[model samples]
Target: MSRELNNTLYQSKSEHNDQELAEHQETNKRLQRLGQEVLKLEAKAVNSLAERIGDNFSRACRHILSCTGRVIVTGMGKSGHIGSKIAATLASTGTPAFFVHPGEASHGDLGMITGADVVLALSNSGETHELNAILPRLRRLGVPLISLTGNPDSTLAREATVHIDIQVEKEACPLGLAPTSSTTASLAMGDALAIALLDARGFTAEDFARSHPGGRLGRRLLLHIEDVMQTGDKVPQVTPGTLLREALLEISHKGLGMTAVVDSTQQVLGIFTDGDLRRALDQGIDVHTTEIATVMTQAPQTAPPHLLAAEAAERMERHRINALLITAEDGRLIGALNMHDLLQAGVV
Candidate 1:
């Protein structure tokens, strides 16, 4: 009887493991199928924009470009979240833009919009009550309205100076209640407008970098050699006639892994790095007595102070080097930097 009881317990545990495995597989299958459906619907919505981006998109870009003041973006609900992101993108991409809540705009926030500013309103359903409530006020202020909506005949659409129809075939939601494809379409439309204006204004990466000074791209684009390079006493430098042993001491003192071989006028003539020391040792050169000019690499690559830190990184990468000397246009060594400096500056 005891043996039978143990056998029963063993069978129960085995069955439970099998059941858990089957449940996990089923859950994974359901998640994958749902993900695929959502992606397909969203892609279809965005692709549909190809056909709709005609004269109206051009007009929106042209009007926004011609506006002397900032672009004021406003929306309600989920549209507001997307509107905020769109406004940020526009602002970063050379179009000055900011988002205001439609509900707030109905209050004293209406004062934020002026005649010089262009209003870009987002509403999947063009008749959002909060947005419609402020249309007359916007009109009174003489602000041009650009509407992004699914219902072109709705109040907001009809009231807009330029109506952009962002209608999607259907939402990815199984119940057709929550916004999915419509919001994706609106966000993509906003990106399209921002990029159009970016190209129209000839916005360069330098301009974008200036606006994003705290970001990694900004560090790379805006940081110059003069900003991070070591100068004055921090530079490990030696005259051409300096002994190799003494130059090694300078390299050790500066901790830059290298030293510049310069002339009397502080003009860089060559460079000696840790690697050069290794080769000198292998070739049986006497470090105590050898002149650095005899062993150092002549006519070493140099950079100007104004060269971007990212460009300096590229130079280091291309040459398989780890250090660079910052020079003036006339070949005077002004500063020095290494791979560690670029890393510390977040340029690499």
Candidate 2:
């Protein structure tokens, strides 16, 4: 190509690249500002919803507490989705509750509701036909009814034993057609109700963990060092004078990649890990004749049996180490654990 033509092409490409970069930056800034505005609106809506809380909320809580059966949450459309989540949260937080789709309730699901149960219904307009249809049956069964709706005078709210208003001043949707602020308000109110009930019922972390046994919450709250740590003969241990070769045998036998070097009182003086072995080998140290204490790390990291396995994992991560010795209050080693153990126990 000619030099002049090549120079012109390069200039055009540079200008195009600059324009594209400018447009990208402007688009990102616009999106960020719009996101912030939406968050502010939602925050304001939640705050307004909180201000509207009154005696009706208290009455609803009392009714729920007094019920001898599960709290049946029923709703339609978007409200139904939110109601299901609320029911799940309530159930996990010590209040027994479950969602019953209002539409399904007419088709034999109504039998799921008993006289001892309390009904918590949701409808943004407070005039959902499906919900209103079941009101008569709920009333006939003598079940207490609590309604969450945007309209105070709607049929569902009027029929409710206690009505908690969830009206929002404006919808976050620019078109004002979609359920936005109203749904957010309802969800926040449901969370408030579930948490209040949880507090009233004295729901503890252990109770919460029991309901979430397969997740990180269960690991952090329910798993202790004693539950996952290697105890007794499984703990690789050697006295101060023990040769590094024998300690290596213990490490291999236990499959923990390390051995604890202890004194006469069984108090851990140092730890010799695979990493230390490599370093010693690099330094031309004789493993067969060397005493483990001579090459061991003094005052190694130790955790108590009562410590959470999650915390132990954190400790190992923070130190960039893979194993920890379980020690008593006076620093005597009682147990041991490794990264693999945490992984196997589902605590990592």
Candidate 3:
């Protein structure tokens, strides 16, 4: 469902908005206090983390970077949930990583372990039984282990080659049992580690786009005119000296509302659009005998075939044109893209 539809699904639309407004006022006070608490705790956690980054964090990064196999991140409960997202972020950002559920690790899933891998364990107390249970076997197999916890002196942290402290003062939850600030701090630390590796590897936006090829940003970054433009026989074009009426026929046949006027070498000369036709009719121009170049817009905006489809879309919008001719570096017409092409490709 759309975000708007999903939001409306649970919201009360009755005339009791005044009562809801009063409740919102109370909630705002609690939220304002909670937001400040979270910020303060996060600042403290990150500051401590900077001190802990000295020697162990560097060793951890080197271990993860040199691993022949994937980085296995594991935690329990709320930490497990955050670890899953952290693993995904790391993997998509160029680090080969995946989450192994701690509970499942104690089961036959332990077979997924390998000697060439690095294990990253997360626990606020640094004593999660399920995670610590399999650490012995990983060590036996010579797998490097890194632990992130609030208690750096705990058993799991002591056993790890590196330990990252993610201690927080209090939970946002009224009851301290809930994992609130700690989980946020842990997730942020994971992001910092993943992004550090991303920068170390020189991972570019285009590389990230390849990992998210189905999303809009991916399309904007990865898609070229060659992917979205009409090419070969689909392009509607006429020689520069062709009759305006002939060019109009091609435009009508192609149904792109425009035609490219090109030379014998296919170098784009100009463009004749529906807007041009309207102006021509107002000027009482003779379409039958008049050359297309006489009425076409001179040096109409052209984009390189390798240009991003999103950029081509922007160019069309900037020039107030509905279509763009795709040319090579030498101005040879190779393709054509209309607004509809961009829309269909989600470049708009």
Candidate 4:
């Protein structure tokens, strides 16, 4: 409790805290180094695949491309996980494919495979018994078998119509027991195959959108201005002879912050927006006395209802506008949409 004793105890605590901090910093450095090493190893494994893309890769792609039925991907354990993702990528990219469990295939799921189909089997060692069990049936069915394996001499590779060697120099795991680098290599190869098939088949963004209709990309690519535009009475509009106050009322009722100044024939003459109202007010123009035509912007930018909503969003951003009028080919106002509608539809 004396001053000297208290000072000595404080010094000891400070030294201990410094030691803990130093240890924490050293541990962080070790962790960062380990992560970097794993990334480098996996990247190298994937890069090595570039050299393996030869006759066998082309053969595998050709077999899948020629198949009348879907590509049935089958594997076990980590390979199975990779196979499933590969199948999904293939299916979404214009090569119809799906994953089937190897163990389940032996238990009657093998019926899924047909003569018209192509089999893509994944196994690091090329000796997965479950995968091999169905090979004879696949062969009997006269289906093309594409095998991806580390060992070209293994049974699956030998039986395959086309073999792609996915061997990695070493696993990212320091113990070299886990399937880290090997699985990464397999995934990379699968992606390469899917992209090649996509390119060969002339798969387009619209086709991709069709497969992913629930995604943001699908909405942006597939949704049209007519699909999200405010139609009928929902669109704000006013005649050129209408008072600014009446146009403001229409704008407020529609909640679009703007209204089209249309002629009696429903042709858009101009557009009056909240910005226009502000400018008019700044110039001391009376809303009740002013005609909307005098304050409206003539020949305002308009889009066709058939235009992609994504394209509309881009146009709005480029022009620094928040709303657009949808017009018919004959220049009549058909509908209207604001940025909020695009946001709600997930096009922006």
Instruction: Report the lDDT tens digits of candidate 4 across residue range 148-241.
Output: 9999999999999999999999999999999999999999999999999999999999999999999999998899999999999999999999
**lDDT per residue as tens, model 2, 206-277:** 899989999888978899999999999999999989998898899999999999998899888999999999
lDDT of 1 by residue, 1-348 (tens): 699999999999999999999999999999999999999999999999889999988888888999999999999999999999999999999999999999998779988888899999999999999999999898888888999999999999999999999999999998999999999999999999999899999999989999999999999989998999999999999998999999999999999999998889988899999899999999999989999999999888899989998999999999999999889989999899999999999999
Clashes of 2: 0
Measured with C-alpha atoms, the lDDT of residue 12 in candidate 1 is 100
Predicted structure with the largest TM-score when compared to the true one: 4
TM-scores vs. true structure, each candidate? 0.96, 0.80, 0.86, 0.98
Q: Model 1 misses residue 124 by how many Å?
A: 1.2
How do the candidates rank by lDDT, highest first? 4, 1, 2, 3
Report every candidate's CA lDDT: 0.94, 0.93, 0.87, 0.95
What TM-score does model 1 achieve against the real structure? 0.96
Worst 10 residues of 1 by lDDT: 105-114
**Deviation (Å) of 282 in candidate 3:** 3.0
Question: How does model 1 fare in lDDT?
Answer: 0.94
Tell me each candidate's RMSD, in Å, in order: 1.4, 4.5, 8.5, 0.9
